[model samples]
Target: MLVDSYGRRIRKLRVSLTDQCNLRCHYCMPINAEFMEVNRYLTPKEYGEIIAELVTLGLEEVRLTGGEPLLRQALPEILTTISRCSLKKISLTTNGILLHRYLELLQQHHILDLNISLDSLKPEIFTQITHGRNLSQIQTNITLAKQQGFRIKINTVMMRGVNDLELFNFVEYAKSENIEIRFLELMRIGQACQQQQDQFIPAQELIDRLKTRYTLQAQAMPLDSTAFNFITECGARIGFIASESQPFCGHCSRWRLSADGILRACLLKTDGLEIRELNHEQRLAAYEQLLGMKPYLRPMEVTHLMHQIGG
Candidate 1:
């Protein structure tokens, strides 16, 4: 088992399969974002081997992420390969644009959770935020996934004047649809930093306001989770990722593996341990060195694009 300098046991890994995405959400990046060449990404077999090796080092959970992970054609094969590993759980974080297309594949592989990124419920605002017209498609997919009994979580980025007004809508939707909704603080990362100073709303502020409308009872958090969850009197589960106003660095145990194979020890840090072309033994050695590089605290500022950093 790999433990960091702070004695935080490293157990979860979030891997970005590709940096390509279909949506250009205002908080993520500009519409015409340029990504790395396809050949630069690790092959399906390579990624499988990497996950397998990490599991041998005490990695317990794995999340497949991307600018939009479903954009990768080999994802099913990749998931199939990793499912054979002795990992405790596997999940996917996506924009939900192509989720319906891969429903069967995800179910067949028994992916434990689906963290869908949906910032707005209003069609017009959703279009404005994502710069895409696939709101209907994504909603349809969400509905279908829920009907099929998938463990679904909606991840919403709360940008001040942009989508913060929809907090009630999100809560109502969660209650009506029987889903979990998480509100994430807008990190000052890459293009998101371009947002007006007034646009970044802390998650705690929203939580405080939510307390007025409903009874919020705090729930015990899972070991690898960063969100603080509250179960409402009405049985609605809401969560907050207070990375800005309240940093959870002391208990953070996950590390990110970028599509190009960089081991990110901190989300706000610009540099990370690169593992792109290393052999199996060399990669393990590099991971050992990377453990020591994990800082006890993050700067609470982001210097890289959130999408490229394996959200």
Candidate 2:
């Protein structure tokens, strides 16, 4: 098994296909920063090559993410290539705006698992969270995806009373719809910090709410994960990704590849080696070096938003 300096086996890679997003969520979207210049970003070809190499080094799983992955036209070819390599799993986390249009193409290319980010169940709340995007369209897209028989995971960030009280509503919806829900703890970052409480809710608090009924087991329990993944008594799966309350740094085996090809050593570490800027040999050597960076037990407060860092 390929291991990082922390002794955490590197098995999964989350690749950010693009930095440009169709919607501007209040939390993740930068207020006034210039986006990555199109010419400066890595194209699908270069990304695929890096993924191929990473797979040889123990990449057992790959999740194609983006500001919205469906924005890229070359993604079908990219997914097709990775799926053909027989990776254990290949999934995409999309906003679901463009999913309806690409549903068939996604299945055709062997991309099955999908993790969609949806924070609100109420239409007005959806509008509030997503900044004016039509909730009805997203709802239609999700319903259509379900009918098409996709292995879907809905990722919702718990914001205090905003979406927290409605958690079980989503859980019930998932149960009725035969879908899975992953309630994530809001991390401190970009637009996330603007909330009075930073809108940061701890994972245990959510699980405690769950404990009122279901027997929950924390998967890959790292203290930092505050993101506990659990299965219900009747076999329904509900997960929590506690990135802040409990730091899962020691067992963090995942690495993120940004649109510009930067290898983030830690989710909180913004500066790491950039693959595009390195020669082939130097790139490999630098990758090895990053895998050898000192592991932190007490991690610093994270400043990068998940969208920017491909969380």
- For model 2, the superposed segments whose C-alpha errors exceed 4 Å read 31-33, 84-86, 196-198, 213-227, 233-235
Off by over 4 Å in 1: none
lDDT of 1 by residue, 61-125 (tens): 98899989999877877888889998899999988888888989888998849999999999999
Candidate 2, lDDT over the whole model: 0.75
lDDT of 2 by residue, 1-311 (tens): 45765577777777888777777777777545356776766776677677777778887888888878788767776676666665788889998888888998888876778888899988878767777566678778888988988888889988986777897788787777778788887766656766726477888888888788778764565542334667776666788776777677776777788887888767677677788866667877877887876356735456666577775
Q: Which candidate is the best by TM-score?
A: 1
Q: C-alpha displacement of 276 in model 1, angstroms?
A: 2.9
Write down the TM-score of every candidate: 0.97, 0.89
Q: List lDDT for all candidates, in order.
A: 0.87, 0.75
